[model samples]
Target: MAFKSEYLAKVYASVEKRNPGEAEFLQAVKEVLTSLEPVVAARPDLVKAGVIDRIVEPERFIQFRVSWVDDNGNVQVNRGFRAQFNSAIGPYKGGLRLHPSVCASVIKFLGFEQIFKNSLTGLPMGGGKGGSDFDPKGKSDGEIMRFCQSFMTELCKHIGADTDVPAGDIGVGGREIGFMFGQYKRLRNEFTGVLTGKGLTYGGSLARTEATGYGLCYFTSEMLKCMKNESFKGKTVVISGSGNVAIYATQKATELGGKVVALSDSNGYIYDKNGINLDVVKQIKEVERARISEYAKRVPGSEYHEGCRGIWSIKCDIALPCATQNELNGDEAQMLVKNGVIAVAEGANMPSTPEAVEVFQKNGVMFGPAKAANAGGVATSGLEMSQNSIRYSWTFEEVDKKLNDIMVNIFHSSYDASKKFGSEGDLVMGANIAGFLKVADAMLAQGIAY
Candidate 1:
């Protein structure tokens, strides 16, 4: 949607002009601003206070050099970034991604989305994100440790327990978080919960690993129930990506009586006619860390396709794109709608293109945006932060219960916002508006300090 409000168009134009060659960042900005066309008209004070402009821009964009030595004793250098986008509600809370695709645009877009995602959780977590372009794949433990340490050397200067709390994202996991946390502890000389996805022995919260995926299922189930008067029970599901989010989503979905038929990775996807074996996928992805193709090899009657995009072609009642950004496009969305897909929820940041979302919403498919849907991981991270501050840990069941409650509440919040904003059942606009109002109002109340 083109911006209807002049203020919104101007704000987006400024963002596009300021961040040239940043396709991902621009896309994120446009989506949020487009949703806020109603809000921009409803709250002129927000526009006058420059809240939209401030929200579009980061509070601090930190870029640094990380130099590490490879196993071959060759010095390697990678760029590390931190975009502290907002801190109106609380400290900077987001994840640090470590992938070769980690660039200014990706980090900025992730950070931008984090602002609202953290807000929608109703937790005092402002938005911030950081990462390095150094791919951790195929690297030995020692090599990864060195790279993480080097990355944290500069990052440690800008983060703290109450300042900026970082977690894991794509190409980042417990192992990487462990190395970075260890380095932060050594350098800062104080053991703090500056990072969320930590080792359990140190400060990690139980269920944090499974939080995002479980949370996604919780939200999806709620959306299905509220809008369609249905549940995941007996639904054919197709989930893209076999990483943490995909793995846990499959587990929870199956437990909820949904048959997940397909799972994928960057290289290819696997289709299991009967149902996906979560154990095999976990073994291939989490334990052995091998390609998802291994699942087809080990599990009989499963077919493996050589392209990841083909996973969306599988017929299903529900679709969860847990893969990276824009992995599902407009055409795939059209295909899903044609296949009788009733609901589509995102498990990754901005996984669906704008066109794809239009396709879903127009076709009457229940759409759950990422900030509201995939907030479980960050929501659990917020719980972990609380536990850290008090030096206490909750049981797995306790945390899981809280996670489910949070996800349910987030769904209603988005749903209510959609209804209030006159976009009944349109969670895309609802989530964006619902997430934006809290921060924007807070920014207004704080006396235009941006």
Candidate 2:
């Protein structure tokens, strides 16, 4: 177990007292704080400067109401949120997820994790996140456009190119980003890159769409090589979530000679005895926007399970949880270990619960923390910001090369940090300590105003 210094524990207690019922936010805070005992013990100045106390709190939090009209001539109202958790290093950078589950606690947890994830990228991007409780699944194109415009009407005032820059998350994709970006450009009358994950016709950079998923595989491969003397070649992989992350992860793993056997969505999971058909998945998801069950129906020799969690039961050498937070619990972790799983990497934000992480660590499963493994998206977003600043764009090959190098560096740094802090081979503590030290130093040098 990771140790928590007395000072760190006290600061976390204060956070819990101040923000009751915010389980997601509290969980994120506790995870990061618990891994910082060595830092506090070695450098008393961090506690003296109140870095932990200030870093745990967001610099600014804004909530607003978004009102739009549906196709049925009904006025729809949704709650919107933007939590600028920390800007100690650079401008705020994160994603905006438009789902029914978008609440303050979820947004804050993501924003808080963004702080460390951005730091690990070695990029000048601070942590921030914004989204709404607007479900875009069943909405028409016109309805989604109206809601995005309305959401940006208030969001634009709080964000800018040099300020907080938002990107796409769960429900906010290229289409949604295009809608919001157009609104931002119309209202501000500036063609700056205020939002990332934009279409190529705009200021978007290449390889941004595949960054997160590809990066997960890259980071995971590095961990396997360094820690286990293994690689992805000839390995079997199970990825949850059929979204951008899972799709690209499956693509990269297949390209690397690994057989991805299963993928899941909200409805259920599909297991292909042979390697999954990427073309079929792309057709069903990207082209048709249908469910995973559609893939099972379209492709022969495939079985579709009724529950999404059952995807974890399929035997595999690697498991990537790209679905959602807490999707993998302790029981799932134990089952994977019992089934001879060797590695577990999170493609989503905090997909593994504390108990699940403990199980993996105790059972010798190579665990890649979400903040380190899933950082490729934000790292490319930072590159996109640079391109926007220079009015230049890099080709897909160039951007992908840079992203791969970044992921490799992140893995090495985390490994070295873990070894340095006496938690050798524990990437969770290594990532937390490495990311925390960077932000903490920046905050200390910048003083308390941050």
**What's the CA error at residue 197 for candidate 1, in Å?**
0.5
Cα deviation at 343, candidate 2, in Å, is 0.5
Cα deviation of 350 in candidate 2 (Å)?
Answer: 0.6
- lDDT digits (tens) for residues 1-450 of candidate 2: 334467877898898898899999999999988888788888899989999999999999999999999999999999999999998889999999999999999999999999999999999999999899999998999999999999999999999989999999999999999999999999999999899998998999999999999999999999999999999999999999999999999999998889999999988999998989999999999989999899888889999999899988999999999999999999999999999999999999999999999999999999999999999999999999999999999999999999999999999989999999999999999999999999999999997766
Question: What TM-scores do the predictions have?
Answer: 0.99, 0.99
lDDT for model 2, on a 0 to 1 scale?
A: 0.94
Give each prediction's root-mean-square deviation over alpha carbons.
0.7, 1.0
Worst 10 residues of 2 by lDDT: 1-10
lDDT of 1 by residue, 104-143 (tens): 9999999999999999999999999989899988999999
Off by over 4 Å in 2: 1-4
